[model samples]
Target: MNILVMMKVTFSTEEEITIEQGEIVQEGISLILNPYDEYALEQAVQVKEVYGGEVTVLSVGPKRYEDTLRTALAMGADRMVLIDDPALMGDEWIVSQAISAFAKKERFDLIFGGQMSIDYASAQMGPRVAVELGIPIVTTILEFTMDGQCAVVHRDMDGYMEKLRVPLPALFTTQQGLNEPRYPTLQNRMRARKKPIVYYIGEDLDFSHEDRQVKTVSQEFFVAPRRSEGKILHGSLADQVKELCDFLRFAIQ
Candidate 1:
């Protein structure tokens, strides 16, 4: 089995985040592997351990993302690939295209990734990549088991569990109940430092100028405005009801 895990670096949720001029301030924020992606990486490593194969971690981000890839290496991935290029940076569509192009360069029996990154929470990358690769995909999977050349997975459908049997060369996006991610041991951490990361730029892949263009024309981020304090209605029940009615009428107007 050759497992491929799609990973991402994201701002740590524990860190204090602030928006300035409609953008996130990233001067001194902590960056780590996307929390949801950890489960996907752990599951891939465990699959490699049981099936006697190699786990490769892949990501498309800036150079600072190398740290997150090294962390995945320490977690038991055999190889790392980073698609780093300023021109390739865009919306999820462009990132998925880059990842799919990389996936085409290698053969993988299974692909694992988080259901969504914590920051954007768009939950579109994995599925988009799957579509680009023309492969079957199971999203928000809670359980996965291999049988012969197929995989049986359990996914959460609202409050119910839906079981599915998918063939090999499929992609899976993991949900929280998948498994606990293990921390890298000191020995593995040391070994990870020695592992080399393979990098790819826009020129390395076949992309036209149109493909490199940003699909999204504009994006804005702003902190939500503070909510006004609630008003208290005093006096008798009828008085309170009258005040509430008046307030509602005024608000509607």
Candidate 2:
């Protein structure tokens, strides 16, 4: 019942973001584990309670991300695998490739991740990795259970329910509606404080390609305008449908 959870550590909203030479200037910014990844981590921990096997937390990012994985360890994953490869920094395809390659090497029976990383909302990374491994990918899984070598999962697709069963060694990237993640208990937090945080460097992994070819570079990074905080579209089911249909009709016309 070995499971692997992929996580990302990101900058908090309170931290100021800047851009220098096209790359995000995150120096001195406070970093935290991706909120969405916490849901995946929570689910994996719950499964650990029943199945009873090692839960390995893995992440591919800059050297600074070790602080983030330590946080996941505090939450209760059994082991950690850090792919310290410089080439993987901020490149989604390479990150997915290197991670999937590493995960396959570990022979984990199940791999779970968040729907997408917060810093980059490209939701295709998980599925893309699964494709690289030639495995089935069930995304947006709200609920799932392991039965022998099979997995029964509940998925939501545009207000419709989708029940699916896939073979073992599959990939799942989930949304937040799946379950509520619990906070680290006092004792666990204390233990986590004493836990060892291992550091790995770029030369550790087998790196074949380093795409140094750059087509363009950015000069700055700025936040987008936040939409209205409230103003529900419509509360009633009928009103919601009417609003949606009217919007669609207007859009088509």
Candidate 3:
């Protein structure tokens, strides 16, 4: 089996984040693998362990994203690929395009990814890639098992659950209840640093920045306004209602 895991590098919320000049400042910011993506990687590694196959982790991001790829390698992905193309970095759709291009380059029997990245939480990349490849996709999968060339999947639907039997060469976006992610061991870390990561740029993939422009643009970045303390009214029921009405009228005025 040839399995592919789509992963992402995200800023660690443990560290303070600051916006400057209409952009997020990278300085003093800590980066790590997206937590949800880690679950996908763990499931891929588990599949490779049970079945005889190679697992490859891939990402579309800047050069610094290699760090997160290395971390994935340490977690048990057999190989890593990074598309460090600044021009191609636009929106979730552009990233999905680049990933679809890479998928076309290499044939994969199964593709796994997180339901959404922590940064954007759009949850569109996996579905977009599946559409571009014309393959079936199942999102928010909680459990997955292989039988021959087909997959037995269990996923959450709103508050209920659904089971499916999807064929091979399909994409799946993992949810939190899928599985627990394992930490890299000391030995794995040593070997991961020595692993070579395949790198590519936008031109190599025949992707033009102008054609891959982001449809949604961020106008500005500002913290959510702080919430004010709640006001309490104490008196007889009628008196409390009258006081609330008075307060509302005064505020509206």
Q: How many clashing pairs per prediction, in order?
A: 0, 1, 0
As for candidate 2, its clashing pairs are 22-218
lDDT (10s digit) by residue, model 1, range 1-253: 9999999898888997898887889768889999889999999998888988999999888888887679999988999989899877778888888888888888999999999999989999999999989999999999999999999999989899999999989999998989999999989999999999999998788877777876774368887788999999999999999999999999999
Candidate 3 per-residue lDDT over residues 1-253, each given as its tens digit: 8999999888997876678887878766888998989999999999999997999998988887776679899999999999888866778878888999889889999999999998889999899999999999999999999998999999988888899999989999998989999989989999999999999887777776565787777788766677999999998999999999999999999
TM-score of each: 0.90, 0.80, 0.91
lDDT of 2 at 251: 79
Using TM-score as the measure, the top candidate is 3
1 versus 3: better TM-score goes to: 3
* lDDT minimum window of 10 residues, candidate 1: 210-219
Q: How close is candidate 1 to the true structure, as a TM-score?
A: 0.90
lDDT at position 187, candidate 3: 96
Point out where model 1 deviates above 4 Å: 229-253
Higher-ranked by lDDT: 2 or 3: 3
Candidate lDDT scores, in order, read 0.90, 0.79, 0.89
lDDT of 2 by residue, 121-210 (tens): 878678888998888999989998887899999999899999999998898988888889887777877776677654444444454545
Give candidate 1's error at residue 24 in angstroms: 2.1
Best by lDDT: 1
